[model samples]
Target: MKHRRSIELQPPAGYAIETERQALATLPQWFVMHARCRACRHQTPIERRDVIRRCGDTLSLATLARRLTCRGCGNRSGNLLLLEKLPRD
Candidate 1:
């Protein structure tokens, strides 16, 4: 049988206690769910199907990326805000 879980997403004070403990250092768990666009300063929602993108600048690389492009423009950027890892196929 498949297990089902529901997650609540509310900005500012979104993350739950358990999720907070699972995070590294001081980073919040909701970071993976809320994505923002630099061009428009617009916030984009992250879906489980969205694939993680990497930067072209290799030397300055800091971490794994999971942002998508702006539907308004051709730009591909976002600050992933919320996410819940789904079951693997």
Candidate 2:
């Protein structure tokens, strides 16, 4: 049977993240990267590794946002949301 899971969104202040690079370094192997274009509101989901490979490991989250382009609108400006998976059962 396939496993199921749910995400618990708590307060951000509960945890301490010193830097963007530091946070990305601790992400799981299979995290989802949510990219959205500000101009056209275009959004896309990409794998963590693919983003890293495309943007390079040395780039920070801010740099990654600037690097990625929207395929739907061909815009360079966008935001990124990093999501991690949690097992429920």
Alpha carbon lDDT of each predicted model: 0.41, 0.59
Model 1's TM-score against the true structure: 0.32
**For residues 7-87, what per-residue lDDT tens digits would candidate 1 score against the true structure?**
434432443434323323344333345455667767665442232232332211113233355665556754334444433
Winner by lDDT: 2
TM-score on alpha carbons, each prediction: 0.32, 0.58
Candidate 2: count of backbone clashes, pairs at least 3 residues apart or interchain:
0
Q: How many clashes in candidate 1?
A: 12
For model 2, the stretches where C-alpha displacement exceeds 4 angstroms are 1-9, 12-19, 28-31, 78-89
For candidate 1, give the lDDT of residue 47: 41
